[model samples]
Target: MIKSIGQLFFLALSCLAIAILQFSFISSFPGAFNQINIGLIAMVFILFFFGIKSAILFIFFFGSFMDIFSFQFFSFHLLVLATVSLVVYLILENWLTNKSLYSFWVLCLIASVTYGFISSILLFVFSGLGGGFSIFSLYFWQSLLYQSLWLLLVASLFFNIFVSLAKRFKPFFLEKKGVI
Candidate 1:
């Protein structure tokens, strides 16, 4: 029990650090660099390797952290992240059953797209209340496209490194023997 608690603490700490870097450092960058969603990428990584429970925990930590820093409505980040997590979990459970690099890449793509779509919808709804931002503009689509591409690039790199260092993702080969 203590070990699990320690793990959760570590997870939360790491999520907090990622959120800080994402919101403070990454978001400060200009153009496409700022469009990269590190939180979503981290959540997808946790989901693929650590399972849904850990991923949910990560989403909670990361989302809450983002929510605290964001200027939007209360729980905005948390809501969008939870929605994305649910959609990704459903996709992994039903359609993408394999835990391979390809599946991870695909999941990253799907998750980014889902995240962008859901967040835009929420932003649009919220904007009706006060804000003046438009979700259907060309800039929004461009930003989403950049975010998805960056996620795919980062996911591929991380997958390759993890597969090399860990046995979990090692491919199994069948050996054929000649009959004597």
Candidate 2:
């Protein structure tokens, strides 16, 4: 129990740091670079490796941190993240049973697309209803495209490196001896 708590604590800190870096540093980049959505990528990674329980906690911290920095209404970031997480979790639990790099990649792709679309839809709706800005423009689509590409690239690189080092993710194979 203590070990689990420690792990959760560590995850929270790391997630918080990721949120800060995402808003403070990554968001400052020009054009498509700023649309990378490292926070969403990190959340997908957590969901893939740490299971839904840890991922729920991660979403809470990371989403809350992001909401703090966002210009939209409170909890907007959290809502988008939670929605994406739920969709990924359902897909992972129901369809994708294999816990391999391929599945992780698929989840990352799904999460990225889902996050972009959901956030855009919400922004559009909110702007229609009240004070938010419109998102139905070329920049939105371009950002989504760039975000998906960046997510897949980063996820593939990280998954490969981590899989190489983590024995748990390595595939098991049987060696055949002489005819028995």
Model 1: residues with Cα > 4 Å off, grouped in runs: 129-133
* Clash number by candidate, in order: 0, 0
Best by lDDT: 1
Candidate no. 2 TM-score? 0.89
Worst ten-residue run, lDDT, model 2? 128-137
Residue by residue across 81-176, what tens digits does model 2's lDDT show? 999999999999999979887898789889988998888788777777674443557777788789989999999988888788876788887878
Q: Which candidate has the highest TM-score of all?
A: 1
Per-residue lDDT of 123 in model 2:
79
lDDT, each prediction: 0.88, 0.85
In the range 55-167, model 1's lDDT, one tens digit per residue, is 88998898998999989887899999899989898999999868998899889988998988888888888878465454658887899889999999999998989889887
- Please give the RMSD to the true structure for each candidate, in Å: 1.8, 2.3
Candidate 2: RMSD to truth: 2.3
